[model samples]
Target: MHGPDVSWYLALSGLMFTIGAIGVLVRRSPLIILLSVEIMLNGANLALIAFARHFGHADGQVFAIAVMAVAASEVVVGLGLIVAMGRRNIELDVDKLRTLRG
Candidate 1:
């Protein structure tokens, strides 16, 4: 299998972002929206790693790692909120959950 070059990785990353964007736009559930946002972050990380490898620079890889840490933290916090919100009801509709928001 061919290793992904910068352009190919960038294209794939852009596609991932687009898919995530659509998911966020079309889904009415908070969990799905959060997952979609994660997809976007992963795409950006992929692009950063790709460019880092291509340029022989450590910065992009370092940034990618940082982004990953952020994404993980986001997932933890978002899921925690989701669980707290879920305890209130079975419905996952974003609109219904808005009432719980301050």
Candidate 2:
């Protein structure tokens, strides 16, 4: 049986990306920004896999894997920084982080 059309996948991906963008723009917490970035990455990944399936090729899947790897590394580094900030009793708000400027 046939699955959902590519357009449906694209619509979902667009919606996810839009939500993530909005979260990043409206939220002041660094943690929320990181999560939103992850969501955007996931949305891109979904579009990549969907296109790969539509084209019957592995290239999109390969790129999606690469994106996932990058996203994982980003999360690791982001969480590490967040933890370090917490240990130092620093505010978690993104606006407050500007004080970190030398």
Candidate 3:
């Protein structure tokens, strides 16, 4: 039995990325947008790991780990903003956040 091909992995990553892009474009809630961005990041990480395995190199895996760290930081910052908005009684709607001008 043969292992899964790289093209299969690439195709799955592409599909996941497309779904994430759609979620980002179509969602209205700030939290949803953040989640969608995380999805996109995960999709990219999936591709990186897949390529690393295919190429038998560590660079892609290293970058994937870096991406994971960035994603974690993103969640922290995004949730902080959400909590701040809640404390300030700001709406969760992304369209209404335009008034946040300092």
Candidate 4:
């Protein structure tokens, strides 16, 4: 059956996802990098919602909701750590978070 204009949405989401990934990779600030990761998650969520609306399936929508919840939890925990780092010491640089030190 013929469908809605979902290709554009998918393309836009793809671009957004790529941008977010690139931002995460290229950025030097931990805060910006975390926000970029969130953007990537949101991009995937947008695509899932579009597919759900286009294919008339509730599963994708449900999955999207789950992703959102996970993303929110991640934001809470991740931002708490960032704030903690900021309060305890200066950690504006992404490389400053050297948790995997030997």
lDDT of each: 0.88, 0.94, 0.89, 0.89
Clashes of each: 0, 0, 0, 0
- Candidate 3 stretches greater than 4 Å from native: 100-102
Model 3 RMSD, rounded to 1 decimal? 2.0
TM-score for predicted model 3 compared with the true structure: 0.92
Candidate 3 lDDT by residue in tens digits, 4-102? 888888888888889999989999898999989988898899899998988899999999999999999989999999999999998888877665661
Which model is ahead, 1 or 2, in terms of lDDT?
A: 2
Ranking by TM-score: 2, 3, 4, 1
True-vs-predicted CA distance for residue 31, candidate 2, Å: 1.0
Q: Which candidate is the best by lDDT?
A: 2
Query: Alpha carbon lDDT of residue 91, candidate 3?
Result: 85
* Least accurate 10 contiguous residues by lDDT in model 1: 93-102
Candidate 2 residue-wise lDDT, 1-102, digit = tens? 198989999999999999999999999998999999999999999999999999999999999999999999999999999999999999898877666692
- Residue 21, model 2: lDDT of 98
Q: Candidate 1: list runs displaced more than 4 Å.
A: 1-4, 100-102
Order the numbered candidates by lDDT, best leading: 2, 3, 4, 1
Collision count of model 4: 0
Worst 10 residues of 4 by lDDT: 93-102
User: In model 3, what are the clashing residue pairs, if there are any?
Assistant: none
Q: What's the CA error at residue 62 for candidate 1, in Å?
A: 0.9
| TM-score of every model versus the real structure | 0.85, 0.92, 0.92, 0.87
